[model samples]
Target: MSDLFDLIIPPNPPREVMADGAMLLRGAALPYETDILTAIQTIATRSPFRHMVTPGGYVMSVAMTNCGAAGWVTDRTGYRYDALDPESGQPWPVMPASFLDLAVSAATEAGYPDFMPDACLINRYEPGARLSLHQDKNERDFANPIVSVSLGLPATFQFGGLKRNDPVRKFALRHGDVAVWGGPSRLRYHGVPKLKDGEHGTVGRMRLNLTFRGAL
Candidate 1:
């Protein structure tokens, strides 16, 4: 297990990757922290945190919510998107302007201009929480890029290739970092390792991750 992360991969983000797809734009959200936080607060009011159960009945350590045209969900039936929040039995919270703007901007920079993501998955990870490596293939369209924004306590992100055993790259994402990927890299597997216990001035002992995608 240690060998899986032994490779101290550097963040050698290439310009072409930024122009085509799959690029890490460090600190892209730093300037918009206030706006993003406000958006999060608004969404939380509508769709509060809930620990979703996986198909295996294991409770996910992360609490999640969503806002947009569609929202991602995982249950005994498997991972899928629904227009309404299953918990509230109503439509998911509306996507805030700030969230939409960031997704669009990040996608455009990654060579998918005019991108307007209709699904946003918000995950809140606390100490010891980790996301298993998996592909974001449940979305309806693979052409649309995935834009992820990181905030609060730092976490190690595992970015792999199309194949499960493909060499993986790691990066410590801090608040305000944005990762955008699509095109041939849209199906790459990725996840986060267990988060160490630590508190952030704004987010406490947790990490916030926003994933924007096109669902319809």
Candidate 2:
């Protein structure tokens, strides 16, 4: 009788995966993908994407822009969050409602509720572009979680321990996936490996990543 009852019950829905303190909310952002893309299009029109130069004078391979109260910028001076766009000399576009709502929802689902992000860094990657492992320590506080949403082409995300030389775990992040990390994993080193050649129907041969954080 009990076995028959079990057979009739449906299986549980997908749940978030935990790696260290990081939470991988698979497919959590799918419902908002269209809206997010639309918001990106509007933001790009205001502040076009560009490859920012590092303080060391090397240009980043990934084209990046931001939408929120603060935008991340890198140059000879160093990497820091500024209220104004260095390129246009105007304030970065406001964070879209869809972007902010998705971020908050993902964070809450990952057990970090009330996660209000004041900055959303948008990264565009074409074939062969890659980001080296680095820690996000520029933020004013580590208490807030970092919420990253993946869209378009799939890519391998390299998540490492606190140390730069620590071994990394590569996770395949697909469109509409969201990864959240905070608390113990707040300062962990992470990055994306070189994107392989691929064609995404809506986005073409590229990938877009939205990383939301609380920055003063």
Candidate 3:
């Protein structure tokens, strides 16, 4: 496996440490690009998109939705995880096989096998959009790792530590990239910098991020 990986993704970037608990695996999901993009398109139709209000009373810059048994949400109350989509008062759209397969395969490739994610957050960022650094602490199981896939235009990912003021590492994530971290890195803070103006043939002037997790 070591030899195979070296041959495939030669010179895997330094495993850049972003914080005490965060690391970046660049282009980790390039091998499964097609399946991930198809999955995103399939789920978008059912759940659609909407800008969610943050707890701070400001609306998020990105449009978001979810698929799977649980979904991540933000509103006047604050950010949290829920089993149903607040918009329709129904369960978030089911996780497509394509999505699940790609996620598991990516996770497995990252040394995490048999990963079963029950929540998949789909975030779309247009030019000038950004996400604040925050921890993914809403899941019932902190033991489960996070598998995040990037598509469309590239964006700089800001990975931080457990605290807000912690130093952060920026990763320029492009289409077909996957980032996976867990164990000691599960609670690290992360976000995306403002997306630059650009357009892709399929996703247009936007970047899509699919984050898979096990939300009780």
- TM-score of candidate 3 versus the correct structure, residues matched by position: 0.86
lDDT of 2 by residue, 1-216 (tens): 888977999444366665756899888888898899999999999999999999999999999999999999999999999999999999999999999899999899887897899999999999999999999999999999999999989999999989999899888998888999998999989999899989998878999999999998
Lowest lDDT block of 10, candidate 1:
11-20
Residue range 1-216, candidate 1, lDDT tens digits: 566566676443333243236888887777778988888888888889889999999899999999998999999888899999998899998898888888888778767896889999999999999999999998888988889999999999898888999888888788888999888889989999899999999878899999999988
Q: Rank all candidate structures by their lDDT, best first, as comma-separated numbers.
A: 2, 1, 3
CA lDDT for candidate 2:
0.92
- Candidate 3 residues lying further than 4 Å off, grouped into runs, are 1-23
For every candidate in turn, the CA RMSD to the true structure comes to 8.4, 2.9, 3.5
Each model's lDDT comes to 0.87, 0.92, 0.82
RMSD in angstroms, candidate 3?
A: 3.5
Checking candidate 1 for backbone clashes, the offending pairs are: none
Instruction: Indicate the residue-level lDDT of 145 in model 3.
Output: 84
| lDDT score for candidate 3 against the true structure | 0.82
- TM-score for each of the candidates: 0.89, 0.93, 0.86
